[model samples]
Target chain A: TQLLEQSPQFLSIQEGENLTVYCNSSSVFSSLQWYRQEPGEGPVLLVTVVTGGEVKKLKRLTFQFGDARKDSSLHITAAQPGDTGLYLCAGGRTNDYKLSFGAGTTVTVRA
Target chain B: GAGVSQSPRYKVAKRGQDVALRCDPISGHVSLFWYQQALGQGPEFLTYFQNEAQLDKSGLPSDRFFAERPEGSVSTLKIQRTQQEDSAVYLCASSLDLGQGVDEQFFGPGTRLTVL
Candidate 1:
């Protein structure tokens, strides 16, 4: 069973539009990470949030960790064609080395 | 520096045949991980290694799936009996440290396995 749930299994928006993807779970985690994956390749880390209620910004992308640490969100401002890919959220526990990943949201930005 | 790499980016196996996938992690990385990703799904953890020790194998699907990292750098995943259901992408990741809360896992391009 998948431990994390992501909304809007797929998202398609035009260039310059804004989009937000959410990851939620009932179980709390010590850390959460966001990754973007392209076809025929592995997922690449975008950001990691360790504290609850923490918001991080990477250029035009914004990431927020829920106060309970059981959920997280990723928002992209002015989406571009280059931003098209699969977005995945993974949760990590205090002592466990394995990560539980959400099914992921496929985002497509059209020009 | 070079990132993690997997050999034979694509593999095709006949049903009931055995196949082996190899992963070479970044140099000096202490943690290695294996994951299986199905179409339209996120990668699922398969196993983990801390140095040369197999720290966790709970995620391994069955005894048919076996992994080893004897020298702590190069690892191999072997499937004893390939089945159609075994088709998926196998990814290898490595981290500089042992903990996941603070370290970033560098992933390889992955090996796509197809069992007919």
Candidate 2:
């Protein structure tokens, strides 16, 4: 089974601070997706990076996929209290519908 | 149109008891998936359905776990003789199509199951 490992399982920062979360894996993937989940709710898709070295931005959040397709990253700028939640990265393999997800990073932005 | 929705936001069952979880996907969604998520962990794939056909179920932990989507709209996951280790949150997701490229999956609130 392919495993995606995320760095900094927990993060706490001030509202104005910036943070970056990393997701790494040895296995290659066809596409990678980023999601943020709040308490009592399922994960909500933030972005999907399909091509190697692809990058996408949503508001203050930026998502990037590695050139090897084995890793990905999510960067949040000027974090706010509303950004406090669990962030997850998932990857989909070629010709497969299943997705392998990283453990997750819990971010807490203090106001 | 409504997003994916799951029934019974939470369930508590005794060991060896039988439990059923239900999922209602978005209208006209052609692909549906079920995943199990332990506390403080990411969701793990459980099964996949394309319309009424169950395409893959390799992620099911054991034979006691069974999932079915009869009409391709609503799906049910039943666990027989449930064990304590089977406790986790069950999430249902749906995508418009799974043809190629990236198919964004929309998820439901999920049903949290606890076995005593």
Candidate 3:
């Protein structure tokens, strides 16, 4: 079973639309990270949330960590075509070198 | 390279053939990791190395898989007797060290292996 679960396996929206993606798990994580991957490239780190109830924003993208650290959400406002790609959430634990990843959400922003 | 670099961005091997994928992590990075990713799925942990020591390898799928980093820099993942099911993208990542709270892992473009 995938330790981390991302909802809305595939998302397609207009260029100006807003969208949200979720990552859930039963196990608590010390830190959770959001990454965006483009075709033929590696995933790039977008943000990291280490504290429960933390909310972080980068431009139009907002990331929130749940109070229990077992869930996370990414919201994009006024999405652009550049936002189209696979969005992955990875959970990490203290002292553990391995990251548990979710089966990612593929977001396609139509131009 | 400023970031992690992987060799042979794409590889095609016949069934029962052996293949080797190489990864060169960022300079001075102490942690190196290997992961396998199937289409439409997240990358799964395969193995990990700290410096030149392999601290964890519990995720290796089978005995045919082997990895090594002899000099604490470059790493190689070798698979023997490849099967069609072994086709996937192999990714390599590197981090400065085990993070106290947050560690950022920089990933390579990944090697796409196709077993026929």
- Interface C-alpha RMSD per candidate, 1 decimal: 1.2, 1.9, 1.7
User: lDDT per model, in order?
Assistant: 0.94, 0.93, 0.94
Against the true structure, what is every candidate's RMSD? 0.8, 1.3, 0.9
Tens digit per residue, CA lDDT, model 3, B1-116: 69999999999999999999999999999999999999999999999999999988999999999999999999999999999989999999999986333689999999999998
* Residue-pair clashes, model 3: 0
Q: Write the per-residue lDDT of candidate 2 for residues A5-65, one digit (tens) a residue.
A: 9989999999999999999999889999999999889999999998999999899999999
Per-residue CA lDDT of candidate 3, range A10-57, in tens?
999999999999999999999999999888788899999999999999
lDDT of 1 at A86: 98
Q: Write the per-residue lDDT of candidate 1 for residues B1-116, one digit (tens) a residue.
A: 59999987999999999999999999999999999999999999999999999989998998999999998889999998898999999999999998465578989999999999
Q: Against the true two-chain complex, what DockQ does each candidate achieve?
A: 0.75, 0.65, 0.68
Evaluate model 1: give its lDDT: 0.94
* Residue pairs of candidate 1 with colliding backbone atoms: none
- Model 2 reaches what TM-score against the true structure? 0.97
For model 2 chain A, give the 10-residue run with minimal summed lDDT: A92-101
